[model samples]
Target: MTAHSPSLTPAFWDASIARAEKDSGVKVKQVVAPSTGRDGYAKQLQASGQFPDLLQSITPSQFTDGGLLKPYDQSWIDQNFLLPQGNAIKGKVYVPPTNSQIIPLVFYNKSLFVKVGAKVPTTWQQFLDVNAKLKSAGITPLELGGNDPFAAAMPLTGALSVDVLGKNPQWIQQRHAGKVKFTDADVVTAATKMRTLVEKGYFEQGALNVSYADSIKNFNAGKAAMYPMGSWYLGSIPKDQWNNIGVFPWPSDDGSVVVPFSVGGSMAIASKAKDPAGATKFAQKWSLDPKNLKALIESDGAFPMLKNKTLADYHVKVSPAFTESYTYVTKTNTKVSSMGWATNDEALPGTGNDDFYAAAQALFNSGDVKGQMAKLDKSWDTATK
Candidate 1:
């Protein structure tokens, strides 16, 4: 079966497939899916007529619209997929999401927090207060990789919308359907928070030029007190610095937690798979097999999408940092998926990812929250109409 994913290196993919093959006795063929990104992959799938046996990065909506993916029967994945709110297509399971992964975590240096005498901030105001204190201590309050621009805005965007969207997860679908506009007051409120942070100098100076890797390095080197990033950053952090780091959810207005979907790469069977049965077996084994799933969680910091165990059974055993983050996730009953997921390629025209990313960057640079909202609303209308 052909597969494409950005999550695993070729070596890791080969090794994982070999292990799955050995355990499940499923003869899986590893064919190239695509070298291009998500949009490119979609086009390639269209050109090829037959979708790859498995795809990563591409969403269910794209495949479903193209009539290239097979729906799943009732199984553990069908029941447990957390972001079903965004992922399902007309009540059908087309994209069976694998390992659960949380994003936009406020990863901070514990030592820095203690040095500043700051408690974990539970609300937006408290969050700002802690940053101000950190800045007073001559530490960069937040190390952001703004050179890559949109990618840098992502974590904060997730943080800002969690409170607004968490309470109204369907706002994403509503916006796509043109029932809601991007210029809505609530949308503007959530977006303006990031502009406010920039205006107040809560992030490091010259953040607009810093790359994501550079931001991570700055945080690890003690140049900053906090770094908002995805849980995937876990694998990249050096082991020696592990004890000094702690992760928490982005503080909300009322201290209520709002988390976006924590899904890792999803797996879907191509309608044209040479080994359809093998593809299904591999998908089930990769997700449900306790041994494989645990290894993925430990090695990659992937949250288990399958909720077969208690918090103690799953998170505490992973690592100190993961335990902290996942504990918040389970305890808060955090909502999955966000506007970030809303603007994918298959998204309604004006609501595509490029438009969303551009809107986010412009907010930080221009500080015209309302104006940006108007522009975004216009873009949505133009594209969706």
Candidate 2:
């Protein structure tokens, strides 16, 4: 099978392939993204006159609309597969999702917090109190880079909504369906809280221009006290940074906890796989094989999509903080962003993601939250119509 991905280096891909082949016994042909970027990986694939056996990070719309896919028989995947047990069935079991991953966590710098005598802020009131304490100690409470402009606003667009408003992923669904108003009170409240945090100097100065990547470094560099990101950082961060990192859920002003979804399923097999039958078997093995993922992903803080023993058993032993964050999202019943590949709006590139950024920016600065929402409603109504 030809495997491709962005960001991870060719060496990393080679190592991964070696690991996969050694474990599974099938040699995987690696189709890595260009050394620089994915300017046209898909076109490059077509230009090369061959499609890989698998493609991930390429979304559902691309699968259905790009004509790059050839429909595979689902029954085939089921008969032989083992792991991600059934993430393959987003719609028609078209492809199997390899490893499920989570995103957007609220992690604190333990050393910094200890130095300031701050507790990991569990409650919203505590968050504010902690912010005040950090300011007095001359520590940047939160490190954010907005120079990328929209980077600092994503957590607001994503997590703060669930935390400050309510745990309703459907608002995003409704907005996409043209069922909910973009300027609704829920959106307004989240925006207001985001602004409050910014105005109160919770984030670092010069944040307006900081990049998210740089902000992450700043957090690790001890320039900030807290970092709001996802579990993927668990793997990426250096080991020394681990002791300083403490995970927590997004703090909600409301009684309900903020909800977050692991970005999406990890791997999806192509319909036109050279070894479609073997590929399905590989998918199952990658996800469900206790030897492969169950113990592996859990140790790394990845909450699997499969509810199998790997997660069920490992939850028995974990750091109290990560456990709580996992439990909160679980008990509250987290959901994926409906406007993402899960729904129709994803068909329009830069439409949903771009529109959300604008809405978040407006809500952050505006005095009249509902009025801001009202404007969004009018615009959304026009766009959909």
Candidate 3:
């Protein structure tokens, strides 16, 4: 079995493996994979003919296109999974998602907001007004980590959530069907919004040099008024600072809530496993195991993807920050899959995600929105072919 490390800690894997061994009588060996650039390593293993029986945190199509994965039983998936066919390829479910996470959630420092006399903004214009106030008061409006290219893309993800997906929930599908391009009016609008933030000096100085871990530290220390990140940021907050933090979905144009989320981490079975049946059994058991789900929530603040399950169902103590963000999104009932980090059927094809990240980094540095959008279109066309 392969697992993403650091985020999905070693203890989490140990607990899940212990449960699978006890329940299925199958011994599982774990291999650690980096959270970023995971697909490159998986592909290397595939080329060496040593791909593991079970894989986590990998893009499904990278393996599905090569006929390397075994499809799950649709009936079983339908019975247990909230997103039963999320990562399906041509109507075949290859990967089963384990949880869900809202990306581009704006987590703000409550004390800093109060200090700057800024209220939580519900509309895009109001959000900018808050930022202007923070800037005028000698506080950085936002915290960003651009050195981790994926981290650099979060602000653009928030913009896309409002300017693109909020307008048309099927934007990704439309791009896949060649009905839209990154240079289209809506997409360009999103890019322009991202550029405006940079040009206005909203983000902290040297953000492009900060790593993801360091960004979390800086945010906790109150160097910035807000940090736009995933809901996973909940678990990273220091216990002492929990009461100082609050969260809101990325603001929309008309003040209607639009929370952009995606299936968190998914697992897939290799088609060439020595014991296909045993592998399937272990995958099924591990995915829905209460022990594993509890660990995921406590460690990463991930929402379980199992049907009829709530964060409270785990019976674990979480900070009020988590409860506030979770309750807000659920009550609004306006969740949409984030196109920037999507992993299911809405995922970008081939090298599209990597290209998007690179393009986003360039946009951050140069503020050349149109050039970056054109680059994305070219990259998309090449990747699809």
Candidate 4:
């Protein structure tokens, strides 16, 4: 199995392997893969004739397109999976949904807000004001891990969530169907907001040099006032700092809560597995295993994607910050597919996510919102062709 490197610790993987071996009688080996570039590790392994039997955390679209993945039985999926169609490619289930997460959440430092006399912001202007206050107090207004392309793109994703998907959840689908372009007014506004933050010097110096792990460490160590990240960040916070952190949805211009979220971390089986049936059984067992699910929730702050399951059903203690964000999303009932993430029906073609990330990083550094948008449109067109 190819697993996301930071998603779980070594001990957790060891325990999971033991559990799966005991339950399914199939030995499991995990390869920790870097969480940079779109499915680069998987594609590299496939090119070298060393692709694993089970894939985790890697987006399956390219593999599915190449007929390298085995499709799951529809009846089995219907009986077990909550979002049965979440990882479908061309009317077939290529990956089994494992968990859900709300991306683009602003996990902020509560003490920093108090120190700067700033309150949680609900509108776009208020959010900027809060950042200005934090900056005036000599605090880095935002923490970003720009060394990792995905992390670098997150702020833009947050902005786009509010300015684009918040108003029209179908924006991605429209773009996919050739009815819209990245240069559209709403998209330009979103990109401009992200560039505004860059121009205001709201992010930490040398953010482009910080790796994802170090950024998380810096945020937890109180070096930054805000970290705009996904809900999964809830599990990465140290226990002692739990009470000092708070979360809010990415602010919108009109102050309405609109979260960008996706059901993620699904696994796919290789079509050429030596033991296809055995691999399939193990995938099912691993995904639905109670112990595995509990560990994932406790360590990754993952929301379950199984039928009749909720975070409460896991019975694991979570930080209050997570509860607040989760409650806010649930109450608002306003969520859209997170841009650049592969959803059930809206998987980006080829290296579309990589292109989007590259464009976002360029915008973050140069503040060329229009040029980046045009670059993204070009890349999108090329990928589709």
> Of the candidates numbered 2 and 3, which has the greater lDDT value?
3
lDDT string, candidate 3, 50-125, tens digits: 8988887677877787889999999988998776765566778777766778888899999989998889999989
Query: Candidate 2 on 163-273: residue-level lDDT in tens?
Result: 422465446446667766655566666667767786787888867668868977887798888776656555445566656678776666643445544334434566667
TM-score of 4: 0.85
Models 1 onward score TM values of 0.86, 0.74, 0.91, 0.85
What's the best-to-worst order under TM-score? 3, 1, 4, 2
* Local error of candidate 3 at residue 28 (angstroms): 4.1
Query: What is candidate 4's lDDT per residue for 1-385, written digit by digit as tens?
Result: 5454454667777887788778888887777676565378888888999898898766776677688989989998889876677667677887777777888789999999999889999999999999999998899999999889999888888888777888987877898889999888879988898889888999899888899989999999999999988778888989998899999888999888887877775568999998999898888887777667776677777777777666777778888887786675445467777888756666566677898888878876686688889888888889878
User: In terms of TM-score, which candidate is strongest?
Assistant: 3
> Residue 259 of candidate 2: its Cα lDDT?
53
Write down the lDDT that model 3 would get: 0.81
Show pairs that collide, candidate 1: 1-29, 101-262, 260-337, 261-336, 261-337
lDDT (0 to 1) per candidate: 0.68, 0.57, 0.81, 0.81
lDDT of 1 at 154: 68
Q: Between the candidate structures 2 and 4, which one is better when assessed by TM-score?
A: 4
